[model samples]
Target: MAATARDIAAELRERIKSGALAPGKRLPGEPALVQEYGVAKETARRALTMLVTEGLAVRRKGSGTYVREFQPIKRVANRRLAPEGWGSGQSIWSADLNTRPMEVTKLRVDVESAPDNIALALNLTDGARTLVRDRVYVVEGEPVQSATSYLPADLVRGSAIEQEDTGPGGVYARLEELGAKPVRFVEEVRARMPAPDEVERLHIAEGTPVVEIFRTAFTDEGTPVEVNRMLLDASAYVMEYHVTS
Candidate 1:
C-alpha cells in the first residue's frame, strides 16, 4: 500500500517539531524524498508545499527549502504602570536593555484607502488615502512585536523621520527625536487564539493564546499622531500601565 501525501507531510511536520530536522537545515531534493518515501514526484511535491504553506519551511527563489527556527512565545499579563522611574530603578526580566537594538525591519508609506474603522480612528474622510506603516519590532535579534500604524499622509510626508529607520528607539522615540513628543498613549488589549500564521511566527504551542493591543498616541495638543494595532505573542510580554486618582 502506498502512503498518502498527507501522511508524508504529517510525518515531516512531526520531525520538525521533534528537532530531528533542525531549523535552517535544507531539506532533501524532491528526488531524495520520492526515493525515501516511495512516493511519486507529484506526491512529494505536494507534501513539501504543505510544509511551506504551514510556515514550517520556506523555499527561496534561487535557494533550496530550509526549515524555520522555532521561537519561544510568551504570555503577557497587564500590570499597573511602574511608578515614576520604577522600570529604570528595578531589574525586571534580566533582558539586556542596553544591548537590545531597535530596528525598523519594515516600513511602508503607501497611500492606502482607509477602512471604516481606520478612517474613524484617524478622523479621516471616508475612503481617504491614508499613510499606513507596517513595521516589525525586533529586539535582541528576535521579532518581539508587529504593528500596522495609520496616519494622515499630509501630516507626516515631509518629515524624514517617517521614512528613516529608527533603531532601538521605537516610533515613540523617533517621534521625540523629530520634536513631536508623544505625551500620552492609550491602549486597549485583548486575547484571542493565535491565527495559523501567528502561531508559526510566534512559535506558539497548541491551545496557547495571543494578545492584540491597539494604541493611539497623542501629543500635548491632543493631536493624534499615530493609531497602531499591535499583535503580540501573549506569552512573550507583560503590559504595564500607570494610573492615578
Candidate 2:
C-alpha cells in the first residue's frame, strides 16, 4: 500500500513543529517528494498545497515551498481598549505592537452617508451623514489589517478627526475633548474566508481566512460614539484577551 498525500504532509508538518524544517527553510519539491514517497506528482503537489493553505508554509513564485516565518502580532484586546492605554496621550494600537513598528497607510477621510447597519449601531437616522476614517495598517511593509470607522458627522465635523493625523492619542482622545469619550467598548469577532477585494487589499493567499471585528465605543452614559470595523489577516495576528474573574 502507498502512503497518501496527507500522510506525507503530516510527516512534513511534524518536522516543521519540531523545528527540523526551520522557518524559511525550503520543503522538498514535488519531484523530490514523488521519488521519496513513491507518489504521483499531483499527490506531492497537493501535500505542499495543504501546508500553504494551513499557513504552515509559503510558496514563492519561481521557487519551492518554504516554512512560513511567523512572528505574529499579539493583539491584546482588553488592555488596548482600556482608558488608561490611550487616554494618557498614547495610541490604542501601541499596546499591540510594543517596539514593533506599525505603519498606517492609504488613509482616506470623508463625510459619507452611513450604511444602514452602521447608522443603527451609532443610533443615527437612516442615511445619516458620518465622518468616515479609513486606513490600512502595515507591519514590516506587509499589510496586516484594514480599519474603517464611522462617527456621526455632526459630532466630528470640525474636529481633528477629519485630519490625516489625529494628533497624539488618535480618535478616542479627540472624542474625549468633544465630550463624547469612549468609556466602554463592545467588540464582536468572527472569522471567514476573505472576499476578492479583501484578498487584493491584504495580499491574502487563497484558502487563508480573515478575522472581522466590529467594535463599538460607548460613552459613560452608554451612548455609542463610534463604530469601527476591522479586518485582520488571520495568519499575522494572535488574538489575546485577558479575562478577569
Candidate 3:
C-alpha cells in the first residue's frame, strides 16, 4: 500500500507538533517529498498545502514553506490598562509574556482627518484632525499585532505622545501627564478573515482570521480622549478579560 496525501500530511503534522521540525525550520519541498514518498507532485503539494491552511506553517514566496513560530500572546484586559501597569515605565506587555522580548517593529505618528466612525466614537466633528500613532508589535521577531491610536490633535499636539517614543510609560502615561488620564475604557472585538493589507502586514496564512479590537479611552469626567483600533493575528493571540461580581 502506498502512502496517500492524508498519510503524508499526518506524518508531517506530527513532526511539526513534536518539535522534530522546529519553528522557522524549512520542511521538505514538494519535489523532495514526491521522490521520497513515491507520490505524485500534486499529492506532495497537497500535503504541504494542508499544513499551510492549518496555520501550522506558511509558504514564503520563492522560499520553501516553514513552520510558523508564532506563540499566542495573551492580552489580559484588566491589568493592561491599569494605571499601575504602564505607568511605572514597565510595558503593559511585560505582564503578558514576561520574559519574551517584544518589539515595536514599526512606528509612524502623524496628524490625520478623523474618519466618520472614529469621529463618532471620539465626539469629533467630521474631518477634525487627530494625532494618529500607528504601531506594529512583534513577538520573537514575528509581527503579531498592529495598532492605530487616535488622540485629539490638540491634546497631544506638542506633547511627547506625538513623538516616535511616548517616553518610558507610553501613550496612557503621557495622557495622564497631559491632564487627560484614561480612567475608563470600552472595547469591542470582532473576528473575520484578514484583509489583503492585514494579510500582507501580519504575514498570516491564507484563510487565517484576524481579531479586531476597537478600544475607547475616557477620562474620569467621561470625555473620550483616545480611540485605539488594534488588529491581531487570530492564531497569534488569546484575549483575556477578568470578571468580578
The alpha-carbon deviation from the true structure for residue 3 of candidate 3, after best TM-score superposition, in angstroms, is 8.8
Over 109-169, each residue of candidate 2 has an lDDT whose tens digit, in order, gives: 9999999999999999987999999999998777889999999999998999999999888
Over all chains combined, what TM-score does candidate 3 have?
0.83
lDDT of 1 at 104: 52
Q: Which rank order by lDDT, best down to worst?
A: 2, 3, 1
Please give the RMSD to the true structure for each candidate, in Å: 8.2, 1.4, 2.9
lDDT of 1 by residue, 82-114 (tens): 112223332212232433455556656566888
TM-score of 1: 0.54
List runs of model 1 lying over 4 Å from the truth: 1-96, 101-107, 166-181
Higher-TM-score candidate of 1 and 2: 2
Per-residue CA lDDT of candidate 3, range 192-221, in tens?
888798999888877778999999999999
